[model samples]
Target: MKKILLSIGGLVLLVIAVLLVAPLFISLEDYKPEIAAKAKEATGRDLEIGGKISLSLFPTVAIEVNDVALANYEQGQNKDMVTLEQMALELQVMPLLSSEVVIDRFVLVKPIINLEIDKTGKPNWELEGTQAPANETATTENSESSDGGSGAGLSGLSLGDVRIENGELHFIDLASGAKEDIEALNLEISLEALNEPLSLDGRLDWKAETINLKADVANLESLMNGGSTALEASVNSSPVNFSFNGTAQQASAFALAGALDLDVPSVKGLTDWVGAPIERQSEETFGPLSVKGQLDLNGSVVAFDDVSLAFDALTAQGALKIDSSGSVPNIVAALSTGVLDITPYLPPETSGGQDASSESTSDGGGAVQNAGADQGWSDEAIDFSGLKSVNADLALKSEGVKIRKITIGVSELGILLQGGKLTADLKQLALYDGQARGKVVLDSSKATPTTAINFDLSGVQAEPLLSDSADFEKLLGTLSSKANLTTQGASQKAMVSNLNGTGDFIFQDGAVKGVNIPGLIRNVSLDALQNSFDEAQSTDFAELSGTYTIQQGVVNNQDLSMIAPLFRLSGKGTVPMPPKTLDYRLEPKLVGDLEGQGGDSGAKGLAVPLLITGSWSDPKVAPDLAGALTDQLKDPSALIEGVTSGEGGVKLPLGDGDDAGGVEEVIEKPKEALQKLFGN
Candidate 1:
């Protein structure tokens, strides 16, 4: 028939020309010590091979190696755990001559791995010094294959393209001196039969950026039969962009369920690329993030449902869970946000000296400055060491919550930490129409950290929370507060000077905007310094309660009280608060029968103590006249009933600008000592 088909193609061209000259008479580097003793009997480390060992067989069986290395753990600095410059392989020589093994490409070109751990956490890719365990024919004759739970050993294998070039991956942790690297790694994989579908695309270079990754699995026999497969991953990087889309459950407990999606654009460069940096004391700048989620994981517990986060102009919604098999990784979350303008993470509002009588207690919400702990409170140095990193139980909520001009309308906050304590509750807080609840905890498991704080608030709105904390807009309206307090100090001026607390407050129809009390009882009004918080001489008050007590930072207010239908007030205090100064005493009375008066302040006509020293930002009120000369030495007609019931008339001035003796010569010597005791 054509010379019998040219004699069977001349015996297939003499067996492909004797398998291409049989590797040029085979000296394959003289079997390189049996190929480096079967790679040191399958990697018990040491496998040198310095260069050249080549072979090939008819468009199939190929192998080429040159300068490989691979050892590790003779201790530290580079015992070389893999280093290959040039490697190439191809198989399927008729299904590995029937032992069935496939693999048609495996190129490596410029690899350099490293992967260490040392300093006690021993790891240099393990497989230490004794190497002898690898039965099943050394798992398909080692071609670097071993994910073998039956089928990553790929049932009758068949992989095709895999080329990694310029690879590098050097990680180190010698006990947290943490180091990482993965440079210029390039990978491309595509498999054809571990039962279909699998592809990977990669690129590396970390920290100095450039990420790019992609993956797809799609079944692969349901991911080698451990169940649900279908995965698609993606990553891009500059400041983060990540993605994932789903289903990879139960591969021996590596379960998953995804839909991640992320974009960062710098959340401090993704926490400085995950090394966690955001140690703020205030040069804040978070940013451009967006999340979106539904992660799930189900094995070591890793949920994250519905999420949807954003930052910079805040917006949140969430659910989270973390659980990593315990030993310190447990988290829970629940979020909500919108309008959480924490002034771009704080520290920018600072304006402290103002007092033109505080401009008549300005309102429209901007005269109450100070807030953020009155321009201070962060003496830094509060590291709580990142709160030991994990254990949490967050819960944040917001809906209006600025933090500079201080405004809060709806808020809910909760946080918990275990093992080094850390509470923080406040569940539900609405201010300015008030309602609050509180808790604060913070115990760093001792050695001086302690801090507890109980709190309560109700019906709030006391002039913008005391004008954003003590800038004092001169009190006005429905308030209620409570505190329990405790401290151990770690700044904030040592927690307000090591405070030991006990607080209470109440306002109700309040007014006190700079005091006038009937013009200091008919004009003993010493020069009227714009009448204090003069909304037309404040002091309306239908109630203004108190109950303070803190020691060690001094503050004691013996049940101060004030009610004013005509007048009735009381006080006694000592506020040492790190020199916030103010030595208190304020007693005014005249609630009944004094003509323009209602009744029963004990039917008193007038009584006055009023001392109030200075420095809670300029205090100093007058009218004590040595307690009305000790009450006219015990009532010698008490200065003719304090000059006909105007106990504070005559301007008994004395805030060091003397004149405590001319109210009609002290009302004529208490009426000439009551007429020499009755001999009138």
Candidate 2:
């Protein structure tokens, strides 16, 4: 029996010897033409083998080739689809008997691959006459292999030294004129066996950035055979760093569930590196960004739970899902944050000087600081094109929020965007000590965009709200307001000109900051009227209420009423928003004595009509002396009665200063009293 086993072993040794010496007798170069012809017949492209090819068999079966190239499609942009400087492969012979592939060495040096898509969407990689038959065979094989019954498949595989040095891959799309080149790619891969861990480390230069990548798969065979395996991967570059620890599987489609961490030192830098730049409103926007999450991705859908995101000065935690199976990607998220400061993402405030007063105003919530026709509003077209890119439903809650100069507290908002229309619903909002509920809709689906806003606010501090929104700090109060407004346009001026709305506001225990109605009436001089906007000349009011309607950019208010200690004030006006001009008239009736006593007596002292005109930035104030004199001319005796007893009609104080004897002299000749009082 020992002799028989020795004889079998000796036969095996003889066979191995013959295999080792086989290459000595046969020249692989002689068959290079046949190999090239076969490849050309299969792919319908020229194959050139320019250098030597050698083969060996002993400890391992090996083949090495140099200078090989394959031609691209005739109409392709590149002449050669692939070019290789050198390639070597080694396989362990003993592993074949056990249905295993053990690669001792597999190295590719200086390999260049060029992939392209023509303008007609034809890819150079799609070899001629290879699609239908290859797909059919793959489908049949996949179906047979689904039951794990394919004997032709390897049972185990191992890679010893697999390396790629200085490899390059280039992709060009003719239709989009986009080109991507990945050069200076060096890679090393290792695997013990099919079920053993596989590791890969590589570096590549892409888009002027050097990227280092590392990956590990716990079981490479399981992953390839429609099973799950543990995976860890990291990619590091100057612009960004990303790492993932996950379980990956490929059954019907590739799927991954993982913990992912990504950090971008500058999102703007990343975008610029990737050849896509974002337009930022401020220098601080789109700067640093980071994300950490538990992520699950299945084909076209990706979900993130326990996700924390930080961008610029904003930080939030959320559960987010994005599904790209539809025409437009759809995102659903629920996020909450401590304080969300969005000012960095807003456009900078307009700067310059105004004509008279440097104050601004707002209608609804749109700041009209630059809403005038000539120089106020910007003529640049507002672009809403990005709204059509995706759809989203987002629920956000924040302890506090800051947008531009306005600060809000304890806010809950729901945002829904679909078909180029975005709606934001303020569920719970606190702003400047006020509670507000509102909904804003922006529809960009049409040629001309449209916006609609409805808001109700109560118990709001008016001073800060106005100051923040419009840079106007003239009014102070606790305010309650309601507004329903709509506009359609593509620019600030056009939108404001098209604005139409109805609103009402009521203020309690407030003072007009820059005007003293009682003092203006008492002095009865042009100088007093001109200086009415002085900061020290404020008139305190117990209550102020007004209702207004807007039409074609003109706000018309006819019921402005204020109850003050020295006078009852009423106003009617038209403010044209497009021009930022005011044509308002305010009437102050002195109902109380100079000592503040006649408020309850119902005695009418005097009525002064004041006209406010010019730009909202620099309004002019003057008394309507002509109108007052007309009333006196009609009722001369009534003027005398009012001047003497402070009762019957509109009265005029004669002297520039407040003196009772001046009224007595004016009472004798009321017409002469009016002329002297007016300086006529």
Q: What TM value does model 2 have?
A: 0.86
lDDT of 1 by residue, 557-652 (tens): 887777655446778889887767778887765332222223333434345566766566445556674674475457534445543354533222
Quick one: best TM-score, which candidate?
2
Q: Give every collision pair in model 2.
A: 357-617, 357-618, 370-376
Backbone clash numbers for all candidates listed: 3, 3
Global lDDT of each model? 0.70, 0.81
Lowest-sum lDDT 10-residue window in model 1? 653-662
Which lDDT value does model 2 have at 488?
A: 92
